[model samples]
Target: MSDANNQTKAAPKHSAMHIAVGLLARRDYSRQQIQLKLQQKQYDADEIETTLDHCQQSGYLDDARFAALLLKSHISKGHGVNKIRQSMQQKGLSRALIEQVLLDSECDWFEVAKLKAQKKYGEAVPLDHPTRAKCIRYLMGQGFDYEQANYALAVEVD
Candidate 1:
């Protein structure tokens, strides 16, 4: 019947809180990320706000925790501080919060660069100028600064 077909086609209604909890149940999400997802789902503004506040108060949504987790993941992947910071920013974390998390992490950018270089180029430093430059560029592309990249290649800069 047309009525049965229409009922079947109608989407099930879900409260913003329900949707948010469902999302968080799978993985942690930044407050802003949740807001965007709820907005995309056409949730009412007030409903979205209420849901976000409840999630935050319930310790389900935390930007800091999200940022920290992202940082740890990036570090494990051999990403430099700059790349990690950029990633957190892209995830909608506040600049202050990103800086605080990075500061608290106490990660050594130089060590990460060196390890990445070692993994990519082996233990011996590249002897040829072009090869060395390529290694430096590669490190920089991975988010290391010039100084860090040079350090990773064991190049001394005056």
Candidate 2:
């Protein structure tokens, strides 16, 4: 059993389209992400590019749709816009696609901040300076800017 486990074997080669399809069947992927994954699997550059173009043409890959889904999922997790934007950028989404997703989302940052703050600190504003600063810091850590964090911390109960 030990000898069998230590045996060396070659990775079976797969066609680029086959690998790309298998990957897409598992989950949505941006074209660049898929290209990188195929590259890691040792696919040829020309094959990877050709397969990617075919997938895009056939609607199996869409960066815009991927971006939208990513944005929605992140927003639902209470993340701020800046954080979501950074995440998308890291995922290799273009600026135009990212901006389009944000514009289409039409989220109210202040309202989301207020809701998130309430979930954490309740409806009342923090009484002391340290606690107040902590609240602000927490929101900022969640990818909010100073203005948004302050607004979240300043929310008052009706």
Candidate 3:
């Protein structure tokens, strides 16, 4: 019948709040990330805004908390501040939030670079020019600045 066919073709309707909550149940999401997801689901702008407000009001969504957790996770994985900032930006976190979380973090980037270098290369600093350059490039790729990369290459690993 046409009625049965129409019913089958119709997508199951879910409120924006319900969809957002379902997503949050799986993992933490930034407000912007949630907005993008809702937009992708074809939610109206007003409905998306209301859902976002409610989620924030209920403490189910907190950008600050998400930023902190993201920073901590990146640091634990031996990522540098630059890499962490890039990741946060890609995740739609605001610059101010990213800076605040990074500022609040107690990670010693120098030490992290050193450890990462040590873990990858070994206790000894690279001596040959080409090998040293390679090591510096590797550290830089991992988001360490030139100074930090040089320090990682020059310092004696203990």
Candidate 3: lDDT over CA atoms? 0.90
User: After superposing candidate 2, which stretches have Cα over 4 Å from the reference?
Assistant: 1-11
Clashing pairs in 3: none
For candidate 1, what is the TM-score?
0.93
Runs of candidate 1 exceeding 4 Å displacement: 1-4, 155-158
lDDT of 1: 0.92
Give the clashing pairs for model 2.
none
Off by over 4 Å in 3: 8-11
Residue-wise C-alpha lDDT for candidate 3, range 56-108, written one tens digit per residue? 99999999989988987887788888889999999999999899898889788
> Could you give the C-alpha RMSD of every candidate to the true structure, in order shown?
2.5, 3.5, 1.7
Per-residue lDDT, model 2, residue 14, is 81
**Each model's lDDT:** 0.92, 0.88, 0.90
Q: Candidates' TM-scores?
A: 0.93, 0.89, 0.93
Q: How far is candidate 3 from the true structure (C-alpha RMSD, Å)?
A: 1.7
Taking the tens digit of each residue's C-alpha lDDT, what string does model 2 give over 7-106? Answer: 6454557899999999999999988899999999888899999999999999999999999999889888788989999999989999999999999999
